[model samples]
Target: MEKLCPRFEKAMGLISTRWVGLILFDLLKGTKRFSEMEADLPISGRLLSDRLKMLEKEGIVKRNIYSEFPVRIEYSLSDKGNELEPVIKAIQFWADEHIPPEETDDTDEQRV
Candidate 1:
């Protein structure tokens, strides 16, 4: 783990950032509006906007703004971004089995 050089470390760092994981997680579902992301994620507007732009620049997300009405915009995963779905699912499975029920707030509820 520590053996990873700074370059890889920085690349991986973006994915592991506080809100980026959840941000990407939700975006993986489908195209989402800025407001939709803001509501679902516990991130500040500026930070979320910044991160989305970063992801777009990284070629992980595609942002499209519509020309109709008040103007609509949405974010969706690119081909490369879709590749991370399996990794996210694996992480979820690992957490479910390894993380203690008491450690998470939803443990009291029935799980799928």
Candidate 2:
């Protein structure tokens, strides 16, 4: 098929955003709560929540509730999500080696 199916579009759309790479990279580090993710990512609350929800729906992220008093929730990568690690790392490695400073508007905050 020439055109992308809605499911394909939806699935690819989940991790094909600006800050998604960073989000997934961080989630791979460990399970993190909503606030922790927000604090680590540069996107706004709405965008982060949207990304998290999309990933969860796509089976790339699994959310858990650990506390009720403060309503604590944590997000981690699912099995499928863990499967993306190598791809992400490969791409990141390529970018780290080739992409230079003054590139796109990605707020990596570190010089290669």
Which candidate's TM-score is highest?
A: 1
Candidate 1 per-residue lDDT over residues 12-99, each given as its tens digit: 8878876677877898789999999888777789999999988999998999989999999999999989898888788879988898
lDDT against the true structure, each candidate: 0.83, 0.82
The TM-scores of all predictions, comma-separated, are 0.82, 0.80
The parts of candidate 2 lying over 4 Å away from their true place are 1-12, 104-112
- How many residue pairs clash in each candidate at the backbone level? 0, 0
Predicted candidate 2 versus true structure: per-residue lDDT over 1-112, tens digit per residue: 4998988797567667777888889888989989998888777899889888878887999999876888889999999999989988887899888887567665554221
Where does model 1 exceed 4 Å of error? 5-8, 105-112
